[model samples]
Target: MVIDLQNVSFKYENVNVIQEITAHFNPGELVSLVGPNGAGKTTLLKLISGTLKPSSGKIYIYDQQSHNLTNKKRAVWISMVPQNPKLPDEISIPDFVMLGRNPHLGLLQWESKEDFNIARKSMSLTEIDYLSRRKLGEISGGERQRAMLALAITQQSPIMLLDEPTSNLDIYHQIKVMKLIKKIHTLKSGFGVTILAIHDLNIAAQFSDRILLFSNGSIAADGMPKEVLTKNNIDSIYGSEVTIITHPEHGTPVILS
Candidate 1:
């Protein structure tokens, strides 16, 4: 397993945001976390990224206790594109993307030519290269989202975690971004893991190798999209009736209401 969560739980202001949960993420899997609002999907991503420590239980990344890894070391293993992250408005897009290289740099070391190359390549892959000179504040929400993804891609970590990556995008951009992520996952012949907390059930079903359905701080279902995204599961967890159809081309589940 690339990541192992052993009875992990997290609390915020005395409320259990994430209850005792055990999960494992294997390499080369594109996993999606899906659920209704306040289901603790984002909180779970934060825990896995080491941004928030679990109140109880443990998280192991490649068999190493997560808490024992330094921030830099953790960054080298996992890269995250947080939902609506705070950005430096005045910073150029390229400059912001270069920050992704920090984990690989020595203290007081400036970014090198190779680092710049990697950043450039990531921006190109994310289709944000044209916005290199623009300040982050000058871009649209969708543009900023892509820039954030570019930054995470530049990190070159083995695990990528994205929180609502398509939230700010339009239909076209959403498909574009999702395809880019899928392409990146397979670039190394399925060498890494990409996990995203996404609200779009159809998108999740289309792209994910596995689906983890979260409900009230715990996993309601876990399995292949076809198995976990059934009508019964959706009606129970989401409290809404949704029709499940198979995609003609992809053969993935399509959720309809």
Candidate 2:
């Protein structure tokens, strides 16, 4: 599934939030959207998730147009993990993840054995099976992040859209989450694509197959990690002097301030 956007512009109350942006995200790729604070990362996620339609131009998931994709159908195709989610405190992690199955069920349908199996498998994939019985509020921050990823996995969408999936996690959990994302990307099954709006440049470089940097409501740079995360581009968009060196072990771009 190629997410093809052409001159896509989004506005709020006559205020332009995303300017004419054109880009293509290919199938079976992991992409990271990176930028400074208030660079419209969240807004772009909303647009891609079918919450907001572009004011001008077009967005296509495969050959289908964005406006034609209803929320119900879109939810089935793309699962999103938001920056901050308000999970009900009393709900267990497994129960919370089961909610992702709503897209596959009828309005009056009840949870079936298959649903529980899917939810259980998702927990296993995220390595959160031990926390399955724990209340969402009782879990640690990293556990909560993993729980959210479990929910996303259970949704079983071909394309996953995540907003700050690693926010507030410790370094260990951060690496864990990135590795899980990479695992999903390389699945033998036809899980198509994954896109995330992230803040950490180093993780973006390390995990993402491609990086798109936004500035002034447009894509300032788009390419592989090595090609885009240069000293000049970082200084221009982030407005800070920084040096970028290749990581000795991983060969990914490492930025030093």
Candidate 3:
């Protein structure tokens, strides 16, 4: 397992936000976390990424406890693209993406030719290579999201966690990003693990190797899309009417409301 959460729980201001969550994520798979707003999905991502420590139990990346890892060590194991990252407005896109290489560099070591190549390739794959000289503050929200993804890809960590990666994108770019994610997963194969927290049910069903359904700060279901994304399960949690049909071409679930 790349990530293992054992009886994990988190609290805020004396209120429990995540409770007794136990799960394991393996490499060579794309996992989607599905839940409504305020369902503790983002909080769970934070815990796994070590942005916040659990109130109880533990999170392990491989055999090491996540909280025990140094910032640099954690960066080597996991790369996370958060929901809203605060980027320096004055930094050029290429310079910002180069920051991903810091985890692999020594103290006082400058970025090398290999580092520049990696960053450039990442930007190209993310379709943001044209914006290399632009300041981060000058881009559209969708473009900024891609920049963040480029930085994460450049990091080349074993585990990738994205929170609403397609949130700011249009339908065209949403599909583009989703396909890009799958492509990355396929190319990386046994060495990489990808996890995403997203709102679009049909997209999640189509792309995920597994789906974790969350409700009221707990996992209501966990399994393949066909098992977890049943009409009853979605309706009970989302409190909305919906129908589930298989895609004619791919045979994955297609949700309609």
C-alpha lDDT values of all predictions: 0.93, 0.88, 0.91
Give candidate 2's error at residue 192 in angstroms.
Answer: 1.7
User: Per-residue lDDT of 1-257 in model 1, one digit per residue for the tens?
Assistant: 89999999999999999999999998799999999999999999999999999999999999999999999999999999999978889999999999999999999899999999999999999899999879999999888988988898899999999999899789998998899889888874777999999999999999989999999999999999999999999999989888888999999999999
- Candidate 2's C-alpha runs over 4 A off are 188-191
Q: List the candidates ranked by TM-score, beginning with the highest.
A: 1, 3, 2
lDDT winner, 1 or 2: 1
Candidate 2 lands at a TM-score of: 0.96
**How high is the lDDT of residue 8 in model 2?**
90
- Model 3: per-residue Cα lDDT over 1-257, one tens digit each: 88999999999998888989999998787999999898888899889999999999999999899988999999988999998778789999999999999899999899999999999999999899999779998998878888888899999998999999988789988898899888877878678999999999889999999999999789999999999999999899999999989999889999899
Quote each prediction's TM-score. Answer: 0.97, 0.96, 0.97
Displacement of the residue 186 alpha carbon in candidate 1, Å: 1.2
Clashes per candidate (backbone, < 3 Å): 0, 0, 0
